[model samples]
Target: MAVTFVLAFGGSVLAQEQWVEFSSPRDGFRITFPGTPGIEDVTWTSQMGYALPARVFTVDRGREHYSVTVADYRGIEKLGIAKSQSCAPGAETCIGGQTRIVGPGYWKSDVHGAITYAVFMLLRRHGTPTGMTWNWAEQVEGTLLQFTNADQSRTSASIYMHDNRLYVIEGDVPKGTPEPELFKMSIGFIRPDGSGSNIYSHRFRISAACAAATLSASDRAPASRRPPGRVSGARTFPASPITFRSMARLPTAARFSRTTGRCQSCGGAGSSR
Candidate 1:
């Protein structure tokens, strides 16, 4: 009976430690977790007051909680357009009209501010921030934050924006537990072709250059294989047209390399950190 008990306990420990890579192809991201996570669809309110579709994937191991929240800002431009059109004609609010509301690239601004907005939200939580810094994962720019809760628990989080999707990856554990570095560092971005990468040469900001590269690649593909009127791994702006001239105005360099399956600007040679 003693030997049987020992074997059962050992097996349980091993099971608890079994970590796996989980991917969300639709969301275009992947991460590691101790176990499969529960996914919940949610409506996330942006700092700009837009109600956006989002998903929260969570896993709980003993006292530790790990989660990844992905918020889609795809339809924000449409929302802005509607809001602008609904305003009374000639009113102060409608002074510049749709051009004022949606045209100044407000959607682009929203995407650029996503990571900072996510960090701002986290700062308002119960924990007191112990550290905050600009960080990167797989050469993708992000913000890293550490906090201490009232109950003395520790929380570590990384906020990243890729292809207009905001990702908030967090891990909360009991007091004195080592920082959840594994969970934080295991994030990878998936390409439209369903491939993922965790390596890059240098940190890169989310920019139109990368988006244009992706769209250009799709355009070059055979029509039958190409996704109609949409760029894979990117949100399509139907209400507001994106001119290639405007895309060129943004900083350039990143390109998806067909042979390497990595960002050419990222150098595509460095090992995953």
Candidate 2:
């Protein structure tokens, strides 16, 4: 999706700019930005105290700021193993018997708790959290937060974890402006082939291979026996009733309206289709 802006002066259109879709295959995600965004590589310290690699893609339109941060957690298990190996003999800080610095499946826990940790960091910002809720975009579960900044600017943020990568998306605009829902809604997970996961209605699932690598013996229990909200390696997600096949039959706007119960373009707050 694209947003076009035209500047008019004296009844004449002077200049135009477009918000174009930007895809980062390396980062495994895509989003729309007012222009090409600046990319920066940085080290991110996870809540579990592991130094992970991260990248930030940002674009500024006047006073408004938009950014998506991708933090890679793929190497966390290795880091945990190294920490455990480096622990002193009979160290009290080691968990799960004295042999490990961290518990079994600690990386999985870290990945699962990423969204909550990211949301906590956002809440710590110099802003008042006006609203927060569990939200899903393109079938990926996440948390969404609305904040009123100290300067009265409004900010909307969403955090999601997919494929062991944590995504933090934020948009801040001056007060009284409509929420930057377009930027927020445009987030899409990308495949290696450059196709977007958003093109289909499917829930994010951890593959059996990933489960084999990450799940500890205790985490391999039956889904019913496992604790609620715990990640299950073998669990299967039910297909969404609203499939792309059915949506393709409807008009574009009608499809979005059917899914959201509101106009996609206007971002209004009514149940009108």
Candidate 3:
């Protein structure tokens, strides 16, 4: 699976930014934050009267608040493996005494239902919603819902299921927050041990590869060719060989730009070429 990264940029004005890795051993996930985020403990009570211990990692930058709320479900697996009747009796390949099966489609459905209900409850707390939209995409492997409360404040959330945990990426920003969808989709769930999950490993690998590619292109210039006190100028760097076929399945607004020209997103003068 090719992971697509989305970044929301407001106006031209930029702030000092630094990206760092934040890992939560308790939650069994890690993510990159633009700045150091504060951690808070909270309780998430489900509709079944089960109180799930959760943690919220948040950072407030200007008017945008980035938060990743992880609710661990290992104590009680909500969407867990079940016996499959299709397996032949006494087959050596049987898992846990029977064929254990759990499909991604089912996982998405269950997670989406839970998230949509939560959104509705939140709206009720703040009065009727003036507008709202619910979305689910297989390509993205997640469900995203956006709503505007009676107060006009916009809150968007993207939910993803990994292992026995639910990752709720919540983004609360003013209407001026640029590309709100980008921020909503930016919350990534990294593996605690970087094993047992190809998606987690793949994401980190892509990030490393992209960073290396950028640095490699910059170092290609010889000392004599580089102007004094000036970073290397833009040059043709071999395009990333990685191709995300699934991203092509996404809407135009969420797909990647496959151009050798200047990066339209950042206007980097051919930096992304």
What tens digits encode model 2's per-residue C-alpha lDDT throughout 1-273? 122323234223212136889999998899988778999999888887789999999988778899999998878877767776776776645322422223433554566577888998999984999989998776677888899999899999888877778899999999888888899878989887788764322222323432232223224445455323322244332222222222222232321222222223322221123
The top-ranked prediction according to lDDT is 1
What lDDT does each candidate get? 0.69, 0.65, 0.48
Q: Rank candidates, lDDT, best first.
A: 1, 2, 3
Q: Higher-TM-score candidate among 1 and 3?
A: 1
Order of models, best TM-score first: 1, 2, 3
Q: Residue 56's C-alpha lDDT in candidate 1?
A: 97
Q: Which pairs clash (backbone N, Cα, C closer than 3 Å) in model 1? A: none
Off by over 4 Å in 2: 1-17, 92-105, 198-273
* Clash tally, candidates in order: 0, 0, 0
Q: After superposition, how far is residue 237 of candidate 2 from its true place, in Å?
A: 2.8
Q: In model 1, what is the error at residue 256, expressed in angstroms?
A: 20
lDDT of 1 at 97: 37
For residue 194, give model 1's deviation from the true position in Å: 2.4
